[model samples]
Target chain A: MESVGLVPVLCVSVVLFVTGVAGVLTRKNALIVFMSVELMLNAVNLSFVAFARQNGEADGMIYAVFVMAVAAAEAAVGLAMVILLFRNRVTVKLDDLDIMKG
Target chain B: MPTFNDLWLASPALLLFFGAMAIMLGEAIVRPASKTGFWALALGTLAGSAALTVVIFLGPSADAFGGMLRVDQFGLFAQLVCTLAALLTVLFSDDYLRALNLRVGEYYSLVLFGVCGMGLMCLANDLMMVFVALEVMSISMYVLCALKRGDPRSVEAGFKYFILGAFSSGLMLYGISFLYGATGTTSLPGIGGFFMGQHQGTQATLVAIGGALLIVGFGFKVASVPFHMWAPDVYQGAPISVTSLMSAGVKAASFAAFARFVYGVIGTHSAGFVGVLWWMAAATMVVGNLGALAQRDLKRMLAYSSIAHAGYLLMALVAASTGNASNNPALASLLFYLLAYTFMNAGAFIVLAAFTRDGQDYTDIDSLAGLGKRHPWLAAGLSLCLLSMAGIPPTMGFVGKFYLFSAAIQSGQVPLAMIGALSAAAGVYYYLRPMVWMYMKEGHTEARVAPVAFTALAICGFALLAFGLVPGPMLGLAQTSLQSLIPYTIPTH
Candidate 1:
């Protein structure tokens, strides 16, 4: 535990965030994309915690908590939207959800 | 601990919050026979909120909840615009909702909730508050966009918005985290102080990256080019009423926050950012105007127009960053233009909403043919709105564009202003195309002009012309409203 520093944690957070972004960009499944968004948010939370520890302030940790709460609310809403899409079109594929275009 | 003063200062947001809760509860309990009661409640709540915002705007600037919220004239003015946008949206929504077979009490509550979020976003002084308020606004909009769940287009629009909006929020949060690492605080003024005080090393890099990410987040929200793919789709898919509120209210709130963030954090230290914003402004203007010319659907065309308007407003931010706070008129121009946009954009959408027939929206440009003959009053009102959007003289949009471009030139951004002017010139052709269809072409159609919606459109068109003719008082108000932000922008000299 003592060996881990802010830089290493931030590196790990960056990796997680990049992976999440890749999942969102490459994946066609809506639910998987939703989960990727959550991963990105969690990565943000990790960075915030590490930064708070480095700064010796409680603000970043509290912000991480706020992020968690917001992410939860977002998850509830995102899942509901996905379900609505499924019910309306019987598929949650991003490619299939193209009833509107130029 | 929060005192009574804090609660009073935050009353506008609290009013909308309680109003939304009451409507939601009323929906579950009474399940009212008509949506009139909910509509009235929403209107009264927005009116009360607007009134409170005006009162605060007139009073001295103050902060609430230990500076998490700033009740300054700038914030109050933005809140007033947002509340007005929500009010006008509700005014035309009841009849349109019934016309489209979307009779639900939740619509009013969600709009109120969304306005509540918008109000908070305008006043938010802390990054955490901004994030929470943004989500509150976006989540409500996501639900509102999908309100017509039976329509696959509507559902798909909501889903796409959710995906992209969430992605941007995540990026913004990560940026905030990096900024916290650099400065050890999330307060705008604190971050400003950190930058102004000599700083060096990896912190500068962090600040640069964080600021870029923040711009990306806001760019997505305001629907600037390169991040604007979802806007036309969402606007064309969602109910017209929702699209109106989204364009006017959401854009106003986001710009308000963006202005504060840029001024507070970067201020005169925006040497690197001005070039980025310059290219963005030029590209957005050309793309949005060119896109609109190709669109045959009125809704999609307006969506593109809204994107172009965002580019114009972004030019104002660029100008503000180039000059000192006391001399710059960019922020004031941004505020004034946002107000003008709210009226004209909302009025145009209400006109579109009025044209629904046989349970479908007639959004095709051809559907407007011969409207000048059959419905002269409605046609005239829409023409006023459209002409204002095209920046013709004696309209508020023209006044706004003049102030914005003059500010850019004053800041030595001549090429940017020229690009804006040329794109705006290109925009006029499409803005007039609809009028040609309305008056010059021949067809027969009857538009159901609800009295409430007509009254709202009349108010909007009247405000545009009246203010355009006498823009002195309103422009003065916009100029004075920006004074409060100066304290947060520490001098880099």
Candidate 2:
């Protein structure tokens, strides 16, 4: 069990999640933001799998699978929306999509 | 082995899922000339599910599907409220969609699908089930928000909701992973048992962090302060019917699961976490009310009001957390408030939908001027709903607020209750402005009303008045529904 510790796996997950959150906050392109969201989800999946391995339980692994399925479904719908927006507004930049404001 | 009993236990959500598929197939094959057929089918399905939920509530409470879902009175109550909200959305959507020239077969199907997700959420006993159910509901809503493809605002609303929703889900998943690492289980009951047996352990900090992250995810869904930036824009941009569903059904479902997680699993382990919620409740009330005060668009105003209402609900959670085991008045109050919010808020949106004529919503406050003189019924209906929203006397909203604030005080959360009361007082100003414009001011009288929408408004107003005048029966129901939750509460061992 000492080949790789749970602490290192968790640390890597945290770094990936932080990077993904940073990308989401800083990226202007809608597609890039969407990809970053996926990255965050994957980071979560890694942690879930790692914990599942450490505990020798299938529950976390099963949850990680469900998360992947949901992520895929979300991406499909999100990309469709981005395409629709591009068709109507001729742009995919987050800043340019603001038509309604206070 | 999974048996017929499991299917029977999950009949409400199952019925909605099957109904959604039926609508999709019927739309593809039959291709009804008018949307009336689809609307009737959708409403019938929701009504059936609600009836089934009541039946389940009457029979017995049991855990089904290997403990993934729990069929209890509490869950059934939430399911009933969600179905009722969806039924009302369908009733009001018929005319609004026709007026907007956005009639499509997929709308009814998506509503059914969304309600199905909500129903599942009400019954989820495991974290994985909760995550899946939430995604199902949110994805359907994103599509529903963008159904009006030609409207730029609708597209933008859908996009923004999708991005933020996905990001929040990621946060929640990370938290769940941490929780699994700490407790070595994903079942709420298992986690509760683990926490009950162990106190101030090495994993305490991890569990606490996981709980906080879970709150953040739920905060986003419920539109609480600091995570509520998307609400006003999305609410203003989406079709009014969809907004009604979001405010009523989605909020109810999220709160049901959230309350279950906090009270059942976290229990007294939430001591440090309660401080975070206390401040969140206070800030949510202040920010939501202050934000609404500056809004000219009625939809945006209502969105902010919804955020403020979430704050009051959060206060109920705070009170419940501190209360004793014998009777959970705060939980009852939260359930009752969700029901009251469903009727009043959806009714107001129906009134706003009534003003649409040619695919555009005339929801600006100025457009409502002279409405009382021109359309007395419409104006009166909106006034009743708005008054309820303001928590005025002789309305359900008033009773709901009374219960919530009193519960907080009972739990010794007097300061939190005070913050809520103050924000609500400020909220009254914006709620009354619409009534003032409707009755006192005189302007263009071009607003049009649909018969169905008006009927919805009348029903909502009646409910608000009836429930407000005598809240005993509904309060009793809310109390009874909470009985099943007592066993799940984790006790420090």
The TM-scores, one per candidate, come to 0.98, 0.97
RMSD of each: 1.5, 1.6
Q: For chain B alone, what TM-score does every candidate structure achieve against the true structure?
A: 0.98, 0.97
Give one digit per residue, the lDDT tens place, for model 2 in B68-134: 9988898889989999899888888888899889879889999999999999998999988898999
Question: How many angstroms is residue B275 displaced in model 2 relative to the true structure, after the best TM-score fit?
Answer: 0.7
Tell me which residue pairs clash in candidate 2: none
- The TM-score of predicted model 1 comes to 0.98
Encode model 1's per-residue lDDT on B388-439: one tens digit a residue.
9999989999899999999989988898999999999999999999999999
CAPRI level of candidate 2 = high
Which tens-of-lDDT digit does each residue in A34-68 have in candidate 2? Answer: 99999899889889989989988887888888888
> What is the alpha-carbon interface RMSD for each candidate?
0.7, 0.7
Candidate 1 DockQ, CA atoms: 0.92
Deviation (Å) of B133 in candidate 1: 0.8
- Candidate 1: segments with Cα more than 4 A from true spot: A1-3, B487-493
Measured on C-alpha atoms, candidate 2 has an lDDT of 0.89
- Scoring each candidate complex against the real one, what DockQ results? 0.92, 0.88
Best by TM-score: 1
Model 2 residue A69 CA deviation in Å? 0.9
